[model samples]
Target: MKNTLLICLFVFAALSCKAQNIIPVEDFFDYQNEIPDGTYIKDINNVLNKFTGTWLGSYDNKNYEIVVEEVVYQSQIRTSLTYDQLHLRYKITDANGTILLNTLPLPDDNDYVAMGQYVNPSGAYQLDYAGYEYDCGQSGTLFIKTFNDNTQMKLYLYLGESPYNEDDCPNGFAEQEFPTNSQMLLTKQ
Candidate 1:
């Protein structure tokens, strides 16, 4: 009888722990739909405006430039939080006046706006770029941070170890035995 009682208590404790760990259904779909309401809302514009104008950088012995503008995005998906998220729109170009990047991934999409700083105070105002693809898996994340005071900007691109799922890798898309230029450094133009 004592053994059965102990087993019952153990089962109850296990079930209680499981119930505590079960997250709510909505918590699983925690997507960044829009900027959350906060006390620092007023300062967001000034921070965003700092990204405007032209910034230059280089990759693969070639030159590139980024242009930022504050504009009104068309209001679509009326009920969605991202329907009219106000922020800086970026345009990237090369020396020969070739469009280098867009919002979506493309052959020439070397740079584009990824997202905005949601929490502001200690959040990252990040961007994504096709940091110079040697093979299929050639994407990287560019972090924008305060370079020389609040006026200037510094852009750093970090290429993770994971390459594309291309058939180039003999053993399931692994990195080759060559030096991969995994980091890019740039300053505001």
Candidate 2:
């Protein structure tokens, strides 16, 4: 009797470990109910591959250099769900070649690094952006859309007015960091 019980318990444990459900990244939000624990929103189709790599662009005499990389993350707060996501880093410099803001060298887990949220219905990827100047409220959503066979891309940054007052700004009115509303063309390198 003891030997039979042990074998049954082992089989059940093995089955439970394989019970995780894998869903395509695009269809993740379509689920009706709250996603169960241990569900994976995977990029099984490699839809995010085209956006990975370095991209460069310029606007208003400032050069923008961005890097996008994909990563797999497991969420402890969201019931241990695992998913694929993108992380972005950027460097902006003035026409005179003066460095303005650079998050390129920061560690991957840095708060200032823009983290990809999801792919929009228009196929553009949206990222949550928060610059180091957040005290002055330099934060917003950034969208990236690829074109010309993924060789070229467009970046649109939509930002809101600062919630902080002048007194909160040690720099005395934070200069807008990125181009707002207008889409800037970027080339993949």
Error of 1 at 168 (Å): 7.5
lDDT of 1 at 56: 56
| Model 2: lDDT to the true structure | 0.83
C-alpha root-mean-square deviation, each candidate: 14.5, 3.5
How much is 160 displaced in model 2, in angstroms?
A: 5.1
lDDT tens per residue, model 1, 1-189: 999999999999988865544332123124345333221122323445555566656665445554544433322334222221123234445567677543323322123343332223333344434433434554445555554554565555455444565466444443321124443344565
Please give each candidate's TM-score.
Answer: 0.43, 0.83
Error of 1 at 101 (Å): 7.8
lDDT of 2 by residue, 42-97 (tens): 89889888889999999888999999999987775786688888888999998988
Clashing pairs in 2: none
